[model samples]
Every structure is written in structure tokens, then in C-alpha cells.
Target: MLPEKTDTVVVGGGQAGLAMSEHLGNCGIPHVVLERARVAERWRSERWDSLVANGPAWHDRFPSMAFADTAPDAFATKHSVASYFEDFARQIDAPVHCGTEVRKVRRVEGGTGFRVETSKGTIEAQNIVAATGPFQKPVIPPVLPELAGLTQMHSSAYRNPDQLAPGAVLVVGAGSSGTQIASELQRAGRRVYLSVGPHDRPPRSYRGRDFCWWLGVLGKWESKTPPVGKAHVTIAVSGANGGETVDFRRLAAAGITLVGRTQGYDNGVLRFNADLVANIAAGDANYLSLLQEADDYALREGLDLPAESAAHVIPSDPGCLTDPILSLDLAEAGITTVIWATGFAQDFSWLQVDTFGPDGKPQHDCGVATAPGVYFIGLPWLSMRGSAFIWGVWVDARHVAQHIAARHSQATG
Candidate 1:
């Protein structure tokens, strides 16, 4: 029975939600941001202690506050990023009602806006921004669900290698999270198995220089995209196809075994695609060439190259005549743990809003949904290549904010 009137009600107070909140405030738009947990709850509850962003530290900055420069160049951990987000909310005086869970947000008749119901109160806004973002849910594939015998955990739950059950581990998905976690588990004296697959454009440099340096130069650390253009350049950070860099040079140097692509798991046995690595490597030369092209483009444009980012090396595992279904019987093999770094999926069920597309994502072009007065921010590529990276969301945010202002003018007119 709480108050039920506001210009806008933004659900979820994560990076995107907060960014939008700040922009709306600046535009003199009266709005409230409702967060189920405290601000950036996912970052506080989910991120790991040793988690250094794969990108760079500069991109972590937000629109309101400059990412302070104590450890500016390095990948700050979850806590560091979370603290920054908290400070950002305070700086903007964002009307973020913490602990308020949005149970439902239904678009009112005429699609003019939504009726937002939160835990503490209810609100009706002519415009609603689904800034909740896409990282709350953990995507555990059905294939691995049946393997109850093996002690399993997702990347989100992993804090340190200690959380793992024990013994040799089968790590699925080679994205940044998977690769970093596997490296840690291996160092902890566990037989680590890395399952590889396809991934998106692995940017060698952040902008014109090393990716890290480019974060500062291109300001991608805090840029935002609207939606349409962002998806085109930046790929989902999810550990799909295989974001795990073949950097076989490092794995070979570390003596890590390249396992088959995981297809599924039954009882305790794991199934793997035998030729995933070979197939990926064959095409990897092409991806590397693309990176080289990007590098040349940067040099031509006089962009600053990232000096701190590692020089990625392609794997040496060559010639897959016809190998497939590589299985490792963990129990017989004495391996006890299985870490599923297998990417993530978006969960909008709690939203209760009928604004999603066929893919269950907010249906928007360049951050503007057909539902009018509604928008999206901080998606992987809401605008351009760097949209979702730490700095990328900034660019997307500004554009979305501008659209909101224009819509506001029309509404109040």
C-alpha cells in the first residue's frame, strides 16, 4: 500500500540500473530505483576474491565517479568494484530503495508505462527502465544436472579452490571465468581438465594500445551503449563456445591437459567432444589474424596499445584426424570434483514484465524498447564494441539517457 506514483521505476540496482538512475537524476527526471538486495548485490554476493577482470581496471569507472586510482591499472576484485558502485549511488543521491525486491512490473494498458510492485511499496511510472541487467541467474546445463554423484559447483559459487570437493576436476567452458578458475584449481594440486569450445572476438587491445591502456584512452572502462550497436561488437562474456584462450603455450608450459569438449554427464561419467580443440585451433589462426588486423587498425589510427595485457598465444595441439567422445571416468581416475564454469543465462521470471523478445531478453533496438518510455542499459553491446566491458556500459548509458529525456519531453508535452 506504499506510494504508487513516480516518473520511472528502475528494477535492479546493479551497474546498469545505477547508471540509468544517475542519468535520470541529472536530467531532472523524478524516478526511483528498486533493488531486491543492496546495490550491486550480484557483485557483492557472486564475484570471487581473486577475480581480476579479464579486461582492465580503468573500465570499472562509472559515469558519476571516476574509478579512483589506487590500483587503477589492475583488475579490481568484486569487493573493490562493489565499493565503487556503492559510492556512486551515494554521490548521485540515487533514490535506491535497498532491500526492495520487484515482484512484478506489468505494462499498463495502452503501453504507456508500467505498474511496478516492490516489496516495500508500489509505484506506477509512465516510463520503466529494465536496468536489472542479465547476470543474476546461474545457467547449469541439463546435461550436467544428472551427474549427481560428482561433487559439482558453478563459477558463481566458487570463491576459492577450497570450495571444490576434491581430487582431479573436470572444468567445463573455457571462457575467462572458466580459464581463470581452472588455473587456480590446478595450482592447488588438483588434476584440472579444461573443456574448450567456440568464443567471440577476443580483443587483443582495449582500444588503440594494449586492451588495458585502451580502457583509459577510449574510455571504454565507463562507456555505455544503447542496445542495437553494442551487441554487434561486444560478445557475451558468458563462457560459451570457448572463451578459454588456447594460450596453449601457457597450458603446455603449465602442463595442463586439454580435454574433449563436454557434451554431457551421466551418473559419474563425463562426455566430451573429441575434436573441439582441434576444430577450434584450425580456425584459431583465422581469429588470431583478425586480432592482428585489429592491431594494425589501431596502429594506423594511432591508438594506444595495452602494455599490461598478456600477449595471447594460440594452442599447439594440432591434427585431429578423427578423435571424439573423450571420456574421463573420474571415480576410476580418482578425480572427485567437477567445476561448471559453463557460462550464464538471463533470468527475467522475477521481472513479471511482458517486455521480452523471443529470446526472453528485453526487446529493444539501441536501448529503446517498442514499449516506449522503457529502455535497457549495460547489455554486452547495447551500442558499440566496448559497450558491456567495464567501460563500455558508459557509452550505452548516455545514449539511453538521451532517449529517456526525449521521451519525457513528449510525455509531459
Candidate 2:
């Protein structure tokens, strides 16, 4: 295969990018997958050891290959999931140009194609697919000021419980990652403090079934639509409050104390809103009640639902905490480690393309870009839900690859 222009270029060779590459490879199309790092770089580099996917093991498996047949119930470790991607790439012989960081992807004149400028060299393609994932950037809040001089770190920077302080630790964020990390730190014998934030709290299981099984049925595992769009209620709220999900149970079992509320930052002490926990808990209860109504409606309509579902059990309030403003109290409290289990952001400065909208996100639907032949896949909430998930990306990838193939045939003719 001589080096030259190809039909399409898929950017960011993670699971989604590789899935596209695999489809293109089988079709015998001329293509190249440019990866800024080795395959599954984010999972290998960012995620911590104690971090298992919030979703179950079966739900976590990617497209084209299943995770180890042995461990199907439990979630796959980051390393294991990474290896699965590596094996998938090797098996399909995907044309992955590793270590090739893309500088910019500009749509060339006359709509002929795109010029993908990379660290290695320049390459032109009739189409470009930005499979660059949402995990491209770490979203550390500006609220945690730099002048505080506390030992601060994002969850991405954290690897294990030992990395936190041996004494008391403060985890600011009550999301799945935040809750889990806080529990781990407590188990490691470090007195832990948590500043919960706005989030949905779900249990690990309901009626002996994994929580994700409920999500799949209730349209979360493979969310047919966006989260806020589906339910007027939040059935997943709790700490022995309503439903049975992992975060609530694990944190409770760990004996992690719930700081009632945080108002603001003072001289050195963290303040709390008087109604912070109460209000959030109340709101979540109302939300869960709405879910209950929906569930009852479904059942009354003769919807013979699975025995174990999110609706079967009620969840308790996974209380909201005060906003963490690391003034001086952090050091005063002997808080050594700060695990920020916040969510993710995207960084597309490297590749300059119209594919990105005002928010700097890829301007594509599913994998279809506004510009002809310029495509993208594996974006957060892309074309409904599950677009970023391992098994789901391929659904969009197959369609994009077919489009790529058609373009190839047209060009050849």
C-alpha cells in the first residue's frame, strides 16, 4: 500500500475511532486512523485503578469484541478495557497511525475535501471523521482558586486511594466517581470529607439485579434519548432514600459522613447553605415520585416489565453538598488530598475545522458532518445516546463507513 491520499481520515483512535477504522478496513477502502496516542489512550492514562465503569461489565463491553468471557457481571477495569481495544485493532488490522497528533483539519477550497495537518506531516482526505472523544479535556472548576495553594488535583490526576492524604481528605463532587473515590479513601483509613454537588444518585443493584439492567430497560443504559428529555423525574436519587444503586449503598457502607451543606468560603472554614442537602434531597424525592408515576403507568398499560428494575426499589437522598471553595480551611482541616470527580470537556484547538460549533464541539450528527464527507463519531450524546459507549459507537460508525465507501466508489468512477 503506497502512501497517498485516502478516502477518509478518522481522528482520535480510541474505541469509537477504531471501530470506524475496522469497518473501513473490512471494506478495503483507502483510509488512515490518526491517533494522538496509542489506542484507548484516555482509559489507559486518565482513569484510576479503583475506578470501575458505573455501568455493569456486560454493558461496558465494546463493539466487535466482548470483554473477557470469564468476568461478565463485574465492570471491566480500565486496563482490561484498554487491552480489549488493542486486541480489536490488531485482529482487524486497522490502519492506525499512532503518535500522529493532528494540528488542524481545514476544509480545502471548492469543497473538494479536507487538509489534515498533523505533527508528523500533511495529508489530504476526501473526508475527515473526528472521533475525538469528550474525555479530551479535564474540567477543573474555577471555583477552586489557584491562590488557595492547597494540594489540589482532578480525578484524572488521581490514580489510587494512596495518592490522597493519609489523614483527612475532602472529595468535592458527589457523582459516581466522587462517591467511589471518597469511599476508597475512607477504606484506606483516611478520614474523608465530601462536598456533594448536583447529581443523580443510583444504587448498584435493584432486587439482586445490576443497576444498569434497570437503566437499559428504563432507557438509560442505551438511552434512546438525552437524559433530561426522557424523565420529568429522577428515580436514581438516594442514600437509603429511594432506589438501590451502587453509589448510595457503597458510600453508606463505607461510613462516609455527609457534610450537611456548604454556604461559602470564609477565613479558613467552609460554609454551608442551610437548606443545601435538604432542598436537593426534597427535589430528588419529587423526581423519584414522578418516575414512580411513569412506572405505574407502564405497568397499568399491561407492560409486563422485568422483575428487577429501577422502579422496583425506592432510593434515598444522596444529599447535595456545598460548593467547594478551597480557601484556607483546606490546609487548616488537614485536608491533604482533593479528588475532583467532575465530568469532562473537549479540546479541539489542535484541529482547526468548521466541524466544531460555537461550543467548540464537532458539528456533526451521529457521524455525519455538515461538510460533505467530513465525519465524526463517538461524541458525547451524539445522535441520541450510547454514541460514546463502546458497543454503540459502531452503530454510527457502520453508517459513516458505508458513506465513506460510496464516496470511494464515486471517486474511482
Candidate 3:
């Protein structure tokens, strides 16, 4: 049931694609949204059962609709988030062809427009917006050897502790997902070991405000990319326990064993980098630096905010840092499961467009690609640091839609 032609074709059905469709409709541009599965398929299927929005409901939503009957500061469950996107798509009347996968997108012959092949049918469009979100492919580092009988899966594939083997669990990457999974397993009476990595330790709430609110009010959301040679670190904050800070010390105190970054797998043993203490210190530094910034901002603005406690600024050393474990035998430790909460990577192999950079990411000025009529949306930091999240996707969608509208106008006029 695919259309033979359209003014544009959006290549996703998530927040970014739906937002793009809404804007395209606003500008009287005819387009259809192509989704491989139901709307918000990843949110509906890929996330863990207990997963909740990392940001509160009010901040992590599109401008068109608010999460119904949900508190502004409350984190919506994964199911609720998927329903929200489904409801948004319905309200916007987006022409989304769910269960229709886009197999390939390439420039049509004669150097004009593009031809898109899909699971349903073929469609030709004047412009195509690659609104595929950031978490397209799970990235599990090859730090561990292929051990027989070990239950290994990415965070996306993880559901609950009961699904894991009845043994100790090793969760790699101490980002929000890793920490949350480790905590869940430990609470379920399974010994858990969490692999620490370079991550930002932002408090869930700082100075009587959510960290997200601080990012917005302090103009941090409008921050640009980091300078050359600076890698963006993952923020280690959680929305679980009704939105609380992810303190490694507290996690260790709760009986989750902390380990350094996974180095590699050797003869019947796992190796770790001897950087556990350094990692903890770096995370503490990040936390304290954010606190200082918030305090300075409040002071300059003459705003009466709650003062953070000394204990909150200074972190206590955990026992694992003092006595780091550089190697472990999985069999000896009774560890039978390994959940990789590392992260995701972008896959653009089907996008046969010369718009990608040396890093294999789409090269665009804002959302407009270097190749004519080829646009990209929803990738992390596509235009700004905030572009990685929900609200930011909407903003980027609008910008890309405007560009497409202008181009369409020029072509028709």
C-alpha cells in the first residue's frame, strides 16, 4: 500500500519522525512516515520491563501533547512512553506505515530526488529525512571471550532478574542502565558485580530542582559539542526509586561489587583495568563540579536555593577501590550471566547516500545533509548536546522540516 510518489518520505516513526511529519503537514507538504514496526517500536519492545524515562515526564516530551494525567516530575514507565508516542502519532494524524521496513535509500538516476525501497513497496520522494533514533544497534565491546554456557546479552535484550541464570551476574558499563540492572539483580538476592567506566555522575536533583531543569534554566541544554580531543561521557543518573541520584558508594554499600573497566578475557579468567579508584575520583569530580556550577548560578541570579550538604559534595571511598580485583574466574565466582549495558552504535549501511563523514555518521549542517535533499534527524548531538533527547528531537525536526519546506517551495515556484 505504499504510495508511488510523495513530496517527502520520513524514514522512522519515533518521536523524531512523528515530529517531522507534523511539521511537514503544517507546511502543506505531502509525506508519509515509514516504520519497520509499530510506532515507537524500540520503546515498546527493546527496553527492559522496568525501564522508565530517564527524564521526568514534563521535560522529556514533545511540545504538542503532555503526558496525560502524569505528574510533571514523575518518570513514566517504558510502556507509558511507548503509548505516549503512539498517542502523539494518532493526534498528529501522521501517515505512518507501520511494519513497513525501509530497506535502502539511494539517489534516483539523473541527480534529482531519491528512490526508497521498503518492505511494503517502493516510493520516490523529493526529500528523505532519516529520523532513525540513536539507539539503532547495541554495541557490546569484545572484552570478553566466548565462554560456553555463559548467558550474555545486551541491556536491550534484558528484561528482569528472573530471566537471568540463577547465579552471580556481571553487568558491564556503570551508566544508568548498568547500575540499575545491577541494583535490581542484587536486590533480587543475586550477587552482582558492576563494571565501572568513564561516566558523568550528575545528581538526579540538585538544589531543589531536577538536574534536567538545571540544564534548561542554566542554558546548558543549548550547549554545543565538546572541543576536539574531548570525548562525551555518559551521564550516570537514574529515574528509578522515584527519581534518585546514582551514587556508586551507595550501590557498593547495598552489596553490589564494583569492578574496573573490563580489559579482556584470558585463559579461563576475565581481566579488568586497574583504574577503579581513578574512575571513582573522576565521577566525584564531575558531581562536585556540577554542584559548584549550580551554586554559582543561583548566587549570581540571587535565587534562594537549598544548599547542598558537604556529604553530597564529597564522596566516600568504597572498599572495592582500595582493593581492586584485576581478574576473576567466572566459574569460581559462580557468575553465569553477563549483561552488557555498554551503549549503541549507528548503522547506516542501507543508506546509500554520500552524506556520511569519516566516522560513519551522517554529515549535516543542522539537519540538512551535504547531499542535496538528503536530511538526517534524531542522531545524538545532531545539532546540539540536547539533540539526543526527546524534546530536542522535536526541535531538530522543526529545523529540518523548515529547510525541506523552503527547498520544496523553491522547486515548485
Top lDDT prediction, candidate number: 3
Candidate 2 lDDT by residue in tens digits, 1-413: 21457778889889888888888887778888888889989888887775555565576665457776326666666777788888888888888898989888787778688888888888888878878876777876765455555677888888887665465777766765676677667777877777654555554554444555655666654555655533322233222212234344336446665553344554556654454455356545544654564466457766654544555444454432434233336666687656666667777676665566777667766677776777778875676566777777887788888888888888888
Better of 1 and 2 by lDDT: 2
Badly placed stretches (over 4 Å) of model 2 are 109-111, 220-224, 227-244, 247-253, 260-266, 272-275, 278-328
Error (Å) of candidate 2 at residue 163 is 2.0
- The segments of candidate 1 whose C-alpha lies over 4 angstroms from its true place after superposition are 1-3, 109-112, 145-148, 200-208, 212-246, 279-283, 298-315, 318-325, 352-354
| 2 versus 3: better TM-score goes to | 3
Best by TM-score: 3
**Model 2 poorest 10 in a row by lDDT:** 233-242
**CA error at residue 92 for candidate 3, angstroms:** 0.9
- Please give, for residues 278-389, the per-residue lDDT of candidate 1 as tens digits: 6456345545654665566667777665632334454454333234337867678676767777766776676555568787777878778867677777666566545655
